[model samples]
Target: MLSDVLRSVRLTGSMLFLVDATTPWRSWAPQTEAFRRVVLPGSQHMVSYHVVTRGRCWAGLRDAPPESFETGDVLVIPHGDAYFLANPPDARASYGPEEAVAFFRQMAAGELPSVVPEGGGGAQQTQFICGFLGCDRRPFNPVLASLPRMIHLRGATALDGAMRHLVDFALCELREPAPGGKDVQLRLAELMFIEVVRRCLTTMAATQAGWLAGLGEPMVARALTLLHGAPARHWTLAELATQAGASRSVLAERFVQFVGQPPMQYLIQWRMQLATRMLAEPGAKVSGVAAALGYQSESAFSRAFKKCAGAAPGGWRRQPSE
Candidate 1:
């Protein structure tokens, strides 16, 4: 069953934060203790979110599906598409459009059956926290574009242990109502997301296809490393190709196929992504960011940044950045 499969996935692993300084939710629940996992049908672009404060849940994607998730595990459906989540050992018995609608209604009515429904099994009950993962789908998200519809990484890795503790700590903070509990939870959620991404990247690095493969390839990695290491270098195709030890055509083609963008394009985008990160830091100057990225003049950097990011560096820096 999908739920059982998901349980296995989540049980396999353990899974940090940005301070957005916002009010936390009035309530909290462990995904294992109190949450709902909804499965959406078809190709819609929506990811189901669950905060596992208590129990366990399952996450599925159209492609490259993830393992089950449990307490101390945070699942990220980057696309916000629908997937299955169930407590029953048999996911097939729980899935059907009509069953889903009823499930949601019962959930809304506080009547949705627990994973271990009465008389069904003596298995320990698991909880699931639910929410949404969304963003504007315009002007293209290359990262998302390269990713398959679904991705799951077991939280069992050594790297995810600290993240697990972070979630536990957040749960404790949420349990005690205080001046900034919500704020702390929100920040902790963001931290959790970063950790997941880190693990995903690591997984990708070891894979044969996907962005990690592209990024990990010695030639491509070299180009990416150089671009990231010193974006200020006036890199031409020839120089980049030389650095990557590939011909221009080979570099261009492989980068597009595996990395999801041409080398130069990837470099520009990566620089912008980094610049955005730096710009969000307190006291980080636009000129400083530009200089670090190899832009000699702020104006030149601004033009390039605007061209890629569709916003001025100063404006991007000013907003309570993502």
Candidate 2:
């Protein structure tokens, strides 16, 4: 399952703010790329999300029709594009970059679940929880690539009971900070994220074409599980097909049709992604990474990594940013 892959990739999460707003309120969150240094520093990719724990609000990316969301609704902005959440769908007010920078500063100062006044001082009515999930962009983030720019999971139907429970639990933890609350909240955020992805996958249409869609197919999903579960193992099409319970030709055709690449090509790309992450770590060695990823020699791994990552492993590690 994709959950297995998520575990392998190590997604970390934390709450950004637990906002309580009233009518005539609106706020904007800029792309997560802007907060790389302050929030989740060194994270190559960051995803922002909001859980409307109470009341109704409108949310969407810039210039798009704001989707209406009520209590229990969750909105995931996978690409970290700038977006706004507001009451009445037409609120012109927005939180700017200066406010965003200050917010992170406050968070860094140990003030979490920061309360900000919205709509020029009024009774706080609408309540929502906003947060971020951070994870490695390298090592093949299929979940990130599979998602659309925005995912709107309505409270009533899109999310299941488990997801709702998680939201409620997270809200409670946020409301009453206890010993180890930070760690608990972080784990809850990550679990909620995984639940959101799982729910989306369940409802995803068969016609949808992406990595998530590929998981719906038995053979392709099986192959994916095997590949993710043991990336270091040298695998051939025949071995994968046999393990996946399909013929080589059938597996190849379906895998390409769904995942947009042959099995071996996908494996090579996945290996390179992993190698980049490994090389980024302090004291990591090229030879160790190459051997770990089943490469016969460091030179071979360097060539493959260059082809996929557009630079040698050493050069990539030396660069200041991904």
Candidate 3:
């Protein structure tokens, strides 16, 4: 089920590199809207994450009390809000937004070396691997919506030990480029990001409410698993409830509480997501997509698409942002 959503969202990871900085250094993560194109072109959403491979640093949103992070730690800016990492959490940035854009552009262009060295040439140093990823945010993206603006994973627990090892292996592969080093690094990056997200779910408080949190609820999780597994099925509220071993009323309430929608409504949105993906393919036809997704006719499918997406199927598919 998680795999289905990830594939539909079109996750694209890129420009991952190691950063080695000396003491009294600060690096700003520019607001994603300003720097996304400089990193990944045509992407709807951008997320920046740093894996602390060695030493220690401070990270937090601008003007917020910075959190101390050491080796084996990971700091994720899930929504691409402006953030900073420094030896001293509140260290003033040497550069601002415009300069940050310039830096990202050069880095994306491969003009910079694989291992970027920065800061004052002091003896003290801290190192981390910086990675950026982009994905579709429109139509539907529950994974990103479930996360907070900032996620700080400490290094003193089991999740931390696992992440550290995965990162260490990825760093080793990049340190010495092999025949398929780049491809390996990209896959490793994707896997590491997925691991980070899983850790977030496992560590989520019982009071949390969101789609990811719903996966931990037995009843809600069962319904979601079924919906994602067979989106094309014509599932009724009663039938779905029976399959999930719950009454219709209870199921609806739980689904609404956790997913912000009823079971049938979620099915429609999930179908539209699949429809959008199909419509983007070469030579795809509205009627063909409609039939494939279990809509009786192209007109019916178009109506649902417009209602959920605020645009007709054909027009939405033709959109440049699609």
* Number of the top-ranking candidate, with lDDT as the measure: 3
Question: Which digits, one per residue and each the tens of the lDDT, describe model 2 over residues 1-322?
Answer: 5765575456887554578788788878777777756777756778878888777888999868888888878888998798889886787675679778677656644685544446745554678877777777664777787788998877776456788788778778877778888778778878888888887787663767678888998889999889877888989999999999999999999999888789889888877877776776789999999999999999999999888878888888887644
User: Per-residue alpha-carbon lDDT of model 3 for 179-259, expressed as tens digits?
Assistant: 866667667777788788878777763557788888989999999999888888899999999999999999999988987
Clash pairs, model 2 backbone: 139-273
Worst window of 10 by summed lDDT in candidate 2: 108-117
Clashes of each: 40, 1, 0
Candidate 3, 101: how far from true, in Å? Answer: 1.5
Residue 17's C-alpha lDDT in candidate 1? 16
**Count: clashes, candidate 1:** 40
| Candidate 2 lDDT score at position 40 | 70
For all predicted structures, in order, the TM-scores are: 0.54, 0.90, 0.93
Candidate-wise lDDT, in order: 0.52, 0.79, 0.83
Cα RMSD of all models vs. native, in order, equals 11.2, 2.4, 1.9
lDDT of 2 at 16: 46
What lDDT does candidate 2 reach at residue 285?
Answer: 95
How well does candidate 1 match the true structure in TM-score terms?
A: 0.54
